[model samples]
Target: MRTVGLALVLASLMAGNAMAQPKWAIVVHGGAGVIARAHLTPEQEAAYRAAMTRVIQAGGEVLAGGGSALDAIETAIGLLEDDPLFNSGRGAVFTAEGRNELDASIMDGATLKAGAVAGVTRTRHPISLARAVMEKSPHVMLMGAGADTFSHETGLEQVEPAYFYTERRWRSLEQFLTQNNLPIPARPEGAAAPDAAAGLAHDEGKYGTVGVVALDQAGHVAAGTSTGGTTGKRWGRVGDSPIIGAGNYASDASCAVSATGTGEYFIRLTVAREVCALVEHRGLSLQAAADEVIQQKLTALGGDGGVIAVAPDGQMAWSYNTSGMYRARLADGEPLSVGIYKDEP
Candidate 1:
């Protein structure tokens, strides 16, 4: 009888310890750039906060219910992509040709498997297509019409190009054109100036990408990123969002990262991979690695943007050099939180 009682006590203690440990965590970002709190009206701030809350809750529920990190991250980014407030999916910025060209990528940390799509025009959810590429196709990346065709072959929903149109985005594109003294008419084939297309100003903090990083109950890490590329981008330009290791990276040994900001800079720096490398090679903590990469390295390179990262142990961290980043986080036993300005808590 005493032996049986001792066994019961040990079992109970083990159960308690498991219950006390955090099961999962998720972090997401809309975009990152020169966002200032004073520039936003109170109503606008409230709306952004509400949207962040909704996204975190939706994704958090999946993590809490024992969903894979891949599912949670994809679910979170898909919500941001569908919302017109962010620079992805329905709200993607217009290219130099006055059209939307989207890019997206997804990564699984356990297996280091990744998939990406670039310059896809009609996919309703580019992130889903990214996953499809990862799972259904053998390729790690697909682009332009090829990606759209693969998306169709995989049975992902397709939307008309008109579905991406938004008055706000059109206005932003017009403003960019006016600032550069470029006419509203489309440039002739092979005549577009690379500088005119590449250097156009972006909306505040809307360098126009959305991303998510999640740690699941099973201890797997996953990340995803989606964007409409740059405003006034030409010649089928693809951004870091669709480039694994630049915009998205994950590793069960280190962390999962999703980035938003200037695609060119991110690509040059390989921002996501740098963070993971720091953690794996230098033994830096996830927070320290993320900060070094986002605040120090990227800043030194004149890159402005940020990243959301989650570690296998449920630690979460985000860092940006820009004035603000649209970000949110949820973890076991913690309150859901969202922020848009540099000074926000």
Candidate 2:
């Protein structure tokens, strides 16, 4: 009898240990948009797929090998930001006035603490500044010049305005302005606007790009998003990126969400938080809630785009109304991806 009891106890302990084994996961996006078959060349599609593959692999390896969730999120986003194809860090889009204004936010779901920076120029890593704000500052968000000041106080590297200039972004801006027939602004001082023949400003109505979500690791969750603010935006437009539970929201009790698409519709719906709340309070599955919000609510509100989410039980979902979204997910140890564009898929 004594031997049997000891054996039973040992079996229970081993089972517990097996269940307690740590698991790691991550999801990412390039940018969501009306990605039509006609728009992508074979080369561009291949490039996006390759880029997403590299970044997701980098982040997944870190998580699979016992990395922190924070590290995973930052590492994944950093890669996307560096890629000019996405609209975040280095490859961010151009504003109406033809300048780069970036916004980013990060949240730890376990602690419910967050940091964000808006309209930051000259900061090498806006997400790092956001982390600094969450960890070091009294505020949840800092914007414009104040954000710059905070970056300086924290010893973050600052760059000249020219550092962000790239032919692609300039060309995109010019194409957008020309397509919309918006009045062209006088060149800054002696500078001349890029030639109109370059298809500049062709896609101006399509500008909002952000990403966020949580991972399935035990007792951990996080949400983050980054973007180049709306193109041709006037009056210092600030979107939901820096707003808690708007552009990004996370909770260990429910899920984490990152939104992309039209910023106004996201703000109108309180899109990120609403999804989490529906799951937490209304008992909706992560997929159902996301569908309702992205498909139903935002659509009814006259907005288009999508969101990425992860529930506590490791359930993952991507919901969108656009032609394509730049997204990838690792679930149950399988690499799954969803995208409209050929390269990102």
Candidate 3:
């Protein structure tokens, strides 16, 4: 009788510990573009990988501490936005007019609520502003000066347009102008030219966005995405990043998805929602749905890029049609995985 009681007590303790352990997962992507190992120097590759790892770990800490999925994803994307290495906020690409424009979106799976901002030039963290729109305003989307004004009203951080000025991004604009044979616009008298070597690789010029999808301990999922839009974009172009169904989608019944790539194709296909539909309606697994949407549907339309998706069951999937994607993942009881090239573990 005594032995049996001791065994039962031990079993109960084990169960308690298991239940207390965190059971969430997170996946993030810097961007998906024509990233070939041969084209990237060793230093550039290492830098990208390090940045991704840092972002994922930062997000993981939130989940481990019992934060909501929405909080984790927003925190992760905020870091990326602050880093000048990725093309979301601080590192945003230059428009045809030599200015930086940014966009971002965030969605809550539990409530099916979302917020987005587009074509904003001065808001520092667009992802946070997107969340503010979802939580504070009655509107689902805001644009241009309106979004900036809301950001101010909401007391979110704001910066001058020049605060986004990075020499690397400036050089990218120069390269684009040179390649297109467009006349290089003269800089203001006191403005400085960017270092010639500061620009990203030529092929990486397009498709630079950052996103995250996460599943928390309570089984809620959330997704968020941010972007500087495509390089040399003109006429106030907004990419899929700020579009809810295209670049970001979340649902407790299925999965949360955040995408990067050609905004037009994503918008036309509603890529993120399409992936969720395949899971909700067709009963497809998260991996199957993401693969089909990224590899087949988007490819058929001449679109390229990838997505990070997390299911309600703590399963995560990342799929891309490009040669490489800057991605990282962290799941309960699994080793952290970060990769920039296709063949990496």
Best by lDDT: 3
Rank by TM-score (best first):
3, 1, 2
The full ranking of all candidates by lDDT, starting with the best, is: 3, 1, 2
TM values, all candidates: 0.89, 0.85, 0.90
Best by TM-score: 3
TM-score between candidate 1 and the true structure? 0.89
lDDT of 1 by residue, 83-184 (tens): 887888977888877888999999999999999999998899999999999999889999999999998888899987877776667767788888888767
Q: Model 3: how far is 44 from its true place, Å?
A: 1.4
Pairs of residues clashing in candidate 3: none
**What TM-score quantifies how close candidate 3 is to the native fold?**
0.90
- Please identify model 2 stretches exceeding 4 Å from their true place: 1-22, 179-205, 336-338, 341-345
The residue-by-residue lDDT of candidate 2 on 248-310, one tens digit each, is 888888888888888877888899999999999999999999999999999998988788887
Each candidate: what lDDT?
0.86, 0.74, 0.88
CA RMSD per model (angstroms): 5.9, 4.9, 4.2
- Residue-level lDDT of model 3, residues 110-188, one tens digit each, is 9999999998887999999999999999999999999999999999999888767777777678888889987666542
Q: Cα RMSD (Å) between model 2 and the true structure? A: 4.9
Worst ten in a row by lDDT for model 3: 188-197
